[model samples]
Target: MHIYSSHVLVCSGTSCTSKKSPELIKKLEEGIKRKKLDEKIQVITTSCFGLCAEGPIVVVYPEGAIYSNVTLNDIDEIINEHLVKGRIVKRLLSGNNEGNNSYESADFFKKQVRIALRNCGVINPEIIEEYIAYDGYQALGKVLTTMTPEQVIDKVLDSGLRGRGGAGFPTGRKWLFAANAKGDKKYVCCNADEGDPGAFMDRSILEGDPHSIIEAMAIAAYGIGSDQGYIYVRAEYPIAVKRLNIAIDQAKELGLLGDKIFGTDFSFNLELRLGAGAFVCGEETALMTSIEGKRGEPRPRPPFPANKGLFQKPTILNNVETLSNIPIIILKGADWFKTIGTKKSPGTKVFAIGGKINNTGLVEIPMGTTLREVIYDIGGGIPNGKKFKAAQTGGPSGGCIPTEHLDVPIEYDTLIELGSMMGSGGLIIMDEDNCMVDIAKFFLEFSVDESCGKCPPCRIGTKRMYGILKRITEGKGEEGDIETLEELAETIQAAALCGLGKTSPNPVLSTLRYFRHEYEEHIVNKKCSAGVCKELLDYIIIPNDCMGCTKCIKVCPTKAITGKIKEPHIIDQEECIKCGACLEACPFGAIIRK
Candidate 1:
């Protein structure tokens, strides 16, 4: 094996790529080559480091020095100061200098358990040998060599590995059902169609460790007696698609896929079918429908995918994350895998944590990890020292967890009990500055626009709820608007055709459940406490904090502010459009939202 004194792992995930990580990689390669240290120093491009806020992350191995927010200029300094000279560059360091600035000591990784993301930042995904070096296909090899199909299913079942795709179904049970079904031909399908807002768990997994997915799917095929599989991924994920294609080609070349895998009689083949970015296609039926060259829409269940699925055959469908865990479960016994998370929900969950948070990125915390730890400890608390008002989990289909339940153990059942489902792992943080009514409206608008119109509850009911929220935010809410929203939500929840329609009203319902007072403030009092709803806001000049240098008057979008040069400003409520231009213009803390 080739040995190097130092190994450089760089972030090539989507977010970092957008920030010109590729360009940064080019600079590093050029610098290392110029210095003739390429043999001594190895540079590899890997997946996300979870701390995406610090894009273009560079981690120096043997030293474990993590450099965040790395730019083209910072790279030369990193090479000269850290790589060649053996001196740590303090400026580009990720964490604080208070002893916890190092990668191992950073608060970001304190609460994270990266099982699905095990090889993400450690190895190059494009190179199949790097994956093999990390024991990537060892699980599949073990399965094909020693374990029987029944033993594989039993092991997964005993592992308590529940489906990571929104609904928390048992993974082994789903496999068993598909395996038991009598079909001339069965198919294993992967749902990489992660349509949830602020969710990128699956995308990161595919990009970081595509081989794991391939290995896991092969294991699943062996377990469920399937020979052909297809990954229904969204077309928007160009990078994931490219990596998956490369991985498949590599696996085929090594005889890991295609036919007689590992010299066994079990022969399997896989293909990729791209979707048109339909939110509804995230549903298993819709995903299958899209894969079959039809318009993406959810079909009636009872004949679930496991029984009669894609192309009228027994099909087992699992999300990207759920599949990523399969190989590990096979390698490590079920009992071993069950020891990590809670009894019901075993294993780590990858969450795409974004919005109003200090450290915004991906995190894979254990199942029973508390929201407080995930938000305060892992998320690094809210930005601008804003008080954490609520956290929206499960995206549009899930509910909002208010501050009262912040300490609740983050398990599958607990989140649902608190009125939110543990969706495909999107935990959006909301600060005190957010208006709950507007927040509800934002998600409702997404639900309304993305609705397939297959059923009235999602197609029509979501539209009605969106309209009501729009009216409420605009200071035009009626007396019984809240009651109407609740009624519509309940109806949608009951009468909807699929999981998408049934859970479509979750955002509105949950916001109404937790932040009812905010709705009351908007409708009954004609005010927005969080200053989010523009129509419900009243800007007032705090005379005590005002220095009054004609700044407010000059900067007012409308001629609302008028006062003498040395005197405190006066805001005309009638003239003020509540654009808060005067607020932005004021150097002093004078402007207040009333």
Candidate 2:
């Protein structure tokens, strides 16, 4: 075995890979081998470091120095200066305030508690040996060798680990139900169809720590008395799909998966199923249906997955983030796990931070952490010195949180109390310039498009509500449009068949609950306060700033602006199409949208 004094950990997660981290890896390896330091130095590809805004992340072990936005240009410097010369490359270091180069010390990762994300940025996901080195399969080994099915379920139950995949259902109870269900044939499944907009929490886990999911699924199968398992991942995640395939093959070779695991009577085999990128398949029943070679659509609950899941068999299904916690809970003990977060919502949550924030990436913070901390402290506040207007959680099926609730603790129930659910952990921060009504319309549009059309309430009712919102944004709203939207939202919530249908009105409802005034303004006054609704905006030239430059007149497609040289310009409101061509052409800060 080749022993190396220093290890180079490069991020190869999807975000960084898109940013050419793979090229960086090849460059570093070739450079290191050229220097004849291959015997003493090792270069390893790991998963996401969560700070995706500054991706292509590279961390050198022994020194724990992290460099961000690493490029092919920066690779030789890293290899020559940091790897060979043993000197820190200060130029490319990220979050290096006051000379601190550690990832943990960076504002983005400082307060994060990474239980689910523990092995993410730390190990080579493709290598089972690296996973095993970090006590990876110890939990499964413990479960199969020392523990029984009932005890395993009990441990999870006592841990208070709720599902991180939106619904916040108790994972242990789901396992217990599956165990108690009367079925000769049973199964364990994983939900990796993460279709939430701006959400990649599950994808990161799959890309970074594929073995953990395999081990956790094996433990789940043991607890639930199942021999067959399937992991339903989206085909859109090509990298994640490839890594999961590699990890599963490695696990089977080591006897961690397949028949007689750990030389016990317990036997289980696993298979991977790819989805056609249906958003509704993120729901368990729909995912199961897709795996069963049917169109992905949700089945009404009552005979839930625990009772009758994939192929008419009793099954237990958990999302990637939820299952990722099982191995840690088994090894650390339930009592130890319960001590981290709030009582009702124990452990940490992994959120994919997007929209208007300084740090747009992935974050794993304790459940009880406040919205204030997540937005300001961890996300580095809203970008461009803009005040935070709202945050949309749970994707198209989620609601928005206004400024008033900034300090509220981000628990599963607390967010629901504020008219939002923790849907798949997509936290999108909106700045003051965002139009609330338009934001609601955006999510509603997504829900409308993604709806399976299996239920009339979701398909037809969401369309009606969207029509009203569209009219309001276009300055054609009627007086009762707000009331009509509220009525339709209530009807859809009450009547929609599956969860995708049921929660489709969440964005409109939550926005209405908090920002009702914005709706009224749009309807009654024909004004969009944020000036985002183009139809409701008028571009006026500020006389003081305008130099009568023909720039505005020259660029206007409709010849809407007219003025002499060195004099103030004027735009014909009737002729302007609100394209803002004149706004872009004006060199002076003259054009104002109202």
* lDDT of every model, 2 decimals: 0.91, 0.92
Question: lDDT: which candidate is best?
Answer: 2
Tens digits of per-residue lDDT for model 1, 386-467:
8999999999899899999988999899999999999999999999999988988998999999999999888999999999
Clashes of each: 0, 0
TM-score for all models, in order of appearance: 0.83, 0.84
Instruction: Give the TM-score comparing model 2 with the true structure, all chains together.
Output: 0.84
Best TM-score among the predictions, by candidate number: 2
Worst 10 residues of 1 by lDDT: 96-105
Tens digits of per-residue lDDT, candidate 2, 1-594, equal 877899999999999999999899898889999999998888899998898999989999999999998889999999889987899999998874577687888988988999999999999999999999999999999999999899999999999999989999999999999999999999999999999999999999999999999999999999988998899999999999999999989998999888888889988888999998888888888888889999988888888888899999998889999999999999999999989989999999999999999999999999899999999999998877888999999999899999999999899999999999999999999988999999999989998889888889999999999998999999999988888888998899999989888898899999889999999999889999898999999999999999988899999999888999999999999999999888888898799889
